[model samples]
Target: MTGDVGRAIGFAVVGALALLAPLLEGRVDDRVAAVGTVAPFVVVAAVAYLSTSGPLFELFARPGDREEGRLYGLASFSLGIAGLAVIYVAFEFPVSAFLVAVFALTVGNLGQELTARYTPDPAVGTSAFAVLGTIGAVCAMLLAGVLGASVPALPLAVFVAASGALLGALIRSVLFVRDDSLVVLSVGLVVWFFLELGLAPTLRRVGIGIALTAALGYVAYGLGTASVTGMLTGVLLALFTVVLGGFGWFVLLVTFFGLGGLASKYRYDEKLDRGIAQENEGARGGGNVLANSAVALVAVVAFAVSGHVGVPSAVFRFAFAGAVAAALADTFSSEFGGLFDTPRLITTLRPVAPGTDGAVTWQGVVAGLVGSAIIGGLSGVFFGLNAPGVLLVVFAGVVGMTVDSLLGATLEGDYLGNQGVNLLATLSAGLVAGLAALWL
Candidate 1:
């Protein structure tokens, strides 16, 4: 077999063994089971060390840097063994966790190899890294949980620091084909340390949520529903909500995005035929997402931080609800209004084209109200808002939507853009909600 084919088969065999090791736990003799458990790690370490001289080296190393590549490869291999030893001796991770770690390492290395070999498509390479990073994160979380149970904080911290350092070093070598180990090591340690402290219980959920959100965003970009920058912006927004507000907030955000996306696509061809469709054919950009969500993200951050300062959490809760409600309202109004034949300008109240700036129609107005009410109702249910609180959110949404139109009529496409208008509207809604919360 060719060298590449031989290496591929070897990696595949190691992965299969790692996966099956856990299943063979009780069935085999004690010594044999122990050997099985350690076999994968040995294979991995050997591959990491020997790969520098093999086809795998060509994948990760630039043509002119073979010597540096060998040094980094040896360092990575040594660190991998050291990390496994720490897990085995210090944390005493179970065979299951070891198997998971082995599987993660295998998958990550495979992804790295594939990404390095395929240089034609940058998106594919990015996607591969994203997938592998996500898998590694999940596996790390699982291993951390297993080791953290009944352990003191100090040991947990040590474990996290060590794992981060090793992984960061390996990643640097793979990505840069050089040894910038300390830089990435410090970054990884700080990031993982904070993650452990802030999101200990929800690490797995956060990992899975982020991974799925990234996948969805990529799909949206691929489908021309959103730009690449928009997809990245959405991913950050989703990550913040998932980390700060938990699953409920994530759900609320997803609901609004899904509904708004569907509405944008409704009668798309008809809108295009009439020359009234959205610019870029409704493909949103980073500016669009941030305009609608920046205020909400600020609220989430404020809410998260308020727990330490004895501030009432309701303030930020209402602010978040109002911001999201305004975003939904604006989206529904703009998208559905374009379907009306004789819309009227918000400022002059005279007949205007369906998609004219500041245009409004009865059907569009009702749709906007319904959309806002949906978010308001969900906030009430999710955040324990009273009747008056819900009403205040809905009121704020309506006011914000009106403000958007007023701004669009005068400033949009003149001194301001669509993103600027959306930003001001959402900010106004958040401010309104905050003020209302003081009274209610």
Candidate 2:
């Protein structure tokens, strides 16, 4: 236990120094600063191997395992140097420099943790250490910014710290089952780095929006409307919206999910009695959410990134609209369509079971059309598409719905599953919308 405490302290101290070196670049000679920046990480790698009681220290350690350890060590060293380079390049922007430094340290530590054969003593878990270490490192970063020629923005600092803490705690909680403390810290750091780099100025604006979305997702999980994995997936989807499309897109996504969830429960008892209800008693999982929203999210990202590439931004908007509309159409058809007793096979006019894969009913078709129309109208309002654009979106959604049924009947349960059918349907809708935008 005493040895464990000592090791933990040593790890924390080394991490703090590594994080602080970037802040000291202005105060020391260039060569001295460079050495200081790289030394801590090298030491960490050596300690990770030498401190372990496992075969890690045996010069004759299993050849394969020894090579792996060497690779991890090299990776840690390279990442440390790369991190220093990013911080140096972004030195003019204190916030960017600090964030990059945090990211570098995270990667190095994670590499070290994964490569090491021995688990650290249980005196302190990696998660708690990460939270404390990150807080300290961030504080050092802020101090460095203050002492340097340029000052860090107060709002940015506060945002980084708060976000880091929240992400740390969330990651630790999620990875508790694995009990690998460093892995948890590394995952959280990487995620934060992505958000900070991707969102930046917008992150400050949409922080509250993301928080609200996360809270609602958790509440839904609590209410048994979504599984725990589903809730996490929803949070990721919400973050993607904030980063890729801002508040309007997030609102549309939430509206679709909320309404779809409610509709799923409307005739639950009847569907259950008919033995055609959704699995997990209507609670959606990560896979289900991903199946429905992945294409839309991809469209939003493409639109956001294409702004500077001279791509007509409107084309991407249409793609986004079509994908969302298709998802809504498919969801409504499945949830509400199952409640009707008049379902028939789309391939043939023969009556089928209520929840038959290729089944369609007039009531369900109308419900899907209504769902698609709602998305189309919202796309017009949010994306500024004219009447022609709106109609194109609606038409594309209906096409996707038809494609989904055709695919379900022919491919589903034999060659393709539900997720595959949904993906193809949404892809078809997005392509059709893109084509319509070109022609009209």
Candidate 3:
């Protein structure tokens, strides 16, 4: 009953916006383009509302009528509308009016809800909707910056937006938009890229990279519930990763991890039961934790007179590059594994069970190896690490995978689960790979 009422209200609001669009578009003056500018929001809102309950809704809606999905759409509508209000107040741009309207539209789309509606259980829907709303909001901000009539921020905005969009699309493809994580990633990367370019003058190069990437990450995690929390998280992470590390490696890491996380999270609802939407809960986040921790541990140990030891520059580069390769391999292996494998246990080559913890198939192993190889090869080109360094990464990746599986199979299995274990394993792999690249 509440759902129906909410939907009705949404419909009404969208309808009102639609009606107002033409009036504003045609009647409003050029200086503001307020009326016309806002029309897109109305269009977006109408599309969103209709999307939830209209023609395409049936195609996408889950069986048995999902109230949560509908409610999420409403929530998104409200949030988007609110975001528009913020933009309007902050910038006083005429386009702010339209921003409101488009936000409403995206709210209606509830891409997150659309993706989650089919799940038998609503638990996943909660996370998915939250993820979608955040991604959508970030995208909205970028869109505003890029499309704004003002000429000054245009180039920077466009570049960041374009980079973000390209990265987002790439992430969407790699993870295949079935999950909410891609939305999270798309939003984060785009925002970071935009700010990195736009605020280059105001913020330190490293600071901008750190801040923007952090912002992106926080938003991606659905940590936007408390804007400060997510932003801070992203900031700290970026500072440690991208800001401290060189762009060549940091950018790729962000790109890979951001996309991989998104891809790993969320899936087509109906497909959830069939394993179509299923992901390794264990592997989902472990690598990042490990990666960050390793860096931190190294920093701490080297905190005193770090310059004296003179850690080989190549070692740092190799470690960073290796981390990137390991992450890529992990994503590819997990993403494509189900498609081609018999799901053999990592311990023995024999087939065990599909979705088994620590399971590794020939298909997955080979694919992971390839993924690492690609990253290693790229590292060679970017850092001039040489064939030996590249080979070390590959070897390290294999070891990493083994470490990851071992963690999953043993100590990590006890409490941390796959997510924690994988993170650790990857970090270990990256660090080891780095060391190997540096020495051998």
The lDDT leader among the candidates is 1
In angstroms, how far off is 338's CA in candidate 1? 1.1
| Location of the lowest summed lDDT over 10 successive residues in candidate 3 | 223-232
Q: On residues 119-219, what C-alpha lDDT tens digit does candidate 1 reach at each position?
A: 64544544454456445534544454554322223323333332332244234433543333232333333443344344343446555656656666777
Q: Can you tell me which runs of candidate 3 are displaced by over 4 Å? A: 1-203, 218-235, 265-271, 274-306, 339-341
lDDT of 1 at 135: 57
Q: How accurate is candidate 1 locally (lDDT)?
A: 0.63
Number of colliding residue pairs in each model: 0, 0, 20
Model 2 stretches astray by more than 4 angstroms: 1-21, 24-204
Candidate that scores best on TM-score:
2
CA-lDDT, candidates in order: 0.63, 0.63, 0.47
In the range 1-440, model 3's lDDT, one tens digit per residue, is 23333443343344244233223433456434443434455455455444556544543333322453442343333344434433443453343223323432334235434544466333233333333433443344455445432222433333333233323332332343223233433344335333433232213544465346645644554521212222233333444444334455555555554645544553424324546443333123323434434443243223222344677556666665665666667665665564544777666656765555676767777877887787777667766766777788777666766777666555665687655665676677767966665566
- Candidate 3's error at 143, in angstroms? 36
Residue 437, model 3: lDDT of 51
